[model samples]
Target: MKFAKYGSITLITFVLVAGIAIPLSPSPQNWLQFPVIPGLEEKARNILYHVPVAWTTVVAFLVSTYYGFRYLKTRDIDYDIKSVSAAGLGFLFCFLATVTGALWAKFNWGSFWNWDPRETSIFVLLLIYGAYFALRSALETEEKRATLSAVYSMIAGITVPFFIFVMPRIMTGLHPGAKEVADPAAISKAQAIADSAIAVGSKTFADSALATVAQMNVGSAVPVVQLKMSPNMLVIFLLGLLGFTLLFIWLLNVRVRLARMEYERSTHHE
Candidate 1:
């Protein structure tokens, strides 16, 4: 158990250092030089930590919702506890991701709140999950609450993919890759031809061909620049993630033990 706890802390530290700190820092050349999209310079740095956190939280919530469903099916309190714990952690990470994204947006798009489709959708997701917790608390009976919450969680989970991917693309938004808009130079001649084949109206074959040629010329004229990372911030972020992970694991273990003891006492009384 001690080793498991320590290992989880170490892994979390590594993830934070590699994922967040190193990417955010501004100096010490030896760290990896991450590639940025052509026009977005320092702003691209947001991709490293922000994207990871958003996706990680999505995964965490999905797992939590899955356990919620399982609890309903089996009437298992353990599953319910696990579901809530994971959801709580997921919520923290989701909020962090949104804040980081907001910072990036302020720098890149000149506003923190743009009501972009992707941003609005994710914000809605946060609200929905927030309501989930509140609804859980409003009920008096644990079993009834868990079952109903599980059903709601499952329904919400069904919309996750749509909100995360599809909804963002259907509208014009400040978010990247929406509607599959790509720099023509990023595609090969053959790929460009393929893209043109299906292109129509404003998105016509002639337009695509012209855009492709223009993109290639522009790209060739510009030189790529890489960003460097600072060591101190990297270490601090690593330590923070490590500390948080260790604390979480310790709390989880304590919760599990307490639940077990409560069950035993209840059994003895019966």
Candidate 2:
């Protein structure tokens, strides 16, 4: 627990200072120099915060679903509490991902909300979980609330992967991996193979999910994070992912504990 707490803080703080304070340069004389990419430029800093937060959102939601399954199997209210607590953290991280992404979009695309496919899918996810809490509050019976919410969490969890990972890459949008990267060097070699399909004059990625665009790597399992960046940037990005994931676990533990105390207190009133 202390390891997660201190490690996350140290890693995140180091990433923040490095991401913000380090200067971008065209010529790299040392490891501290960051070569500037044309399309991303300063906007690339958001990757440190945005992608990791989005990843954490997926982790939290899946954990919630796992707890939901546990509750269903054991019929334990404690599992129910864990499920709901995880969902709450998922929502918070989801919201943060959205805000950070919007900030990236505003500078890069000239708008905060462009209704990109990824953005739309994430918004839909928010609504889905928003309804989960609503459904919970509408039920007064403890058992009934737990049962229905558990079922809903399971269903909602199925969409988390589809919405975050699948739909975003499959559909064309302004976000990374969805839209073509103006700078060819930023894309992976897999995208170069996709260029052959583009040579056939079939560049309409938005036409269908299977449509091939130069930057759209449909085969990539983690397309969103498949950024071909410098070694320095890659290290920072990986650290961000690790730090946020630890932070999520620590926060989830605390949230579950608080929810359990609340559950006990309310039941005692009965």
Report the number of the highest-lDDT candidate.
2
**What digit string (tens of lDDT, one per residue) describes model 2 on residues 22-132?**
889977677898877645667678888899998898788888889989999999999998899889998999999889888776555444775777889778868877998
- TM-scores, all candidates, are 0.63, 0.80
Model 1: worst 10 consecutive residues (lDDT sum): 220-229
Evaluated at residue 252, the lDDT of candidate 1 is 56
Against the reference, the lDDT scores of all candidates come to 0.62, 0.75
Q: Give the TM-score of candidate 2.
A: 0.80
Q: Write the per-residue lDDT of candidate 1 for residues 58-115, one digit (tens) a residue.
A: 7667878888988977898888877777777778877987899898765544446656
Top-TM-score candidate index: 2
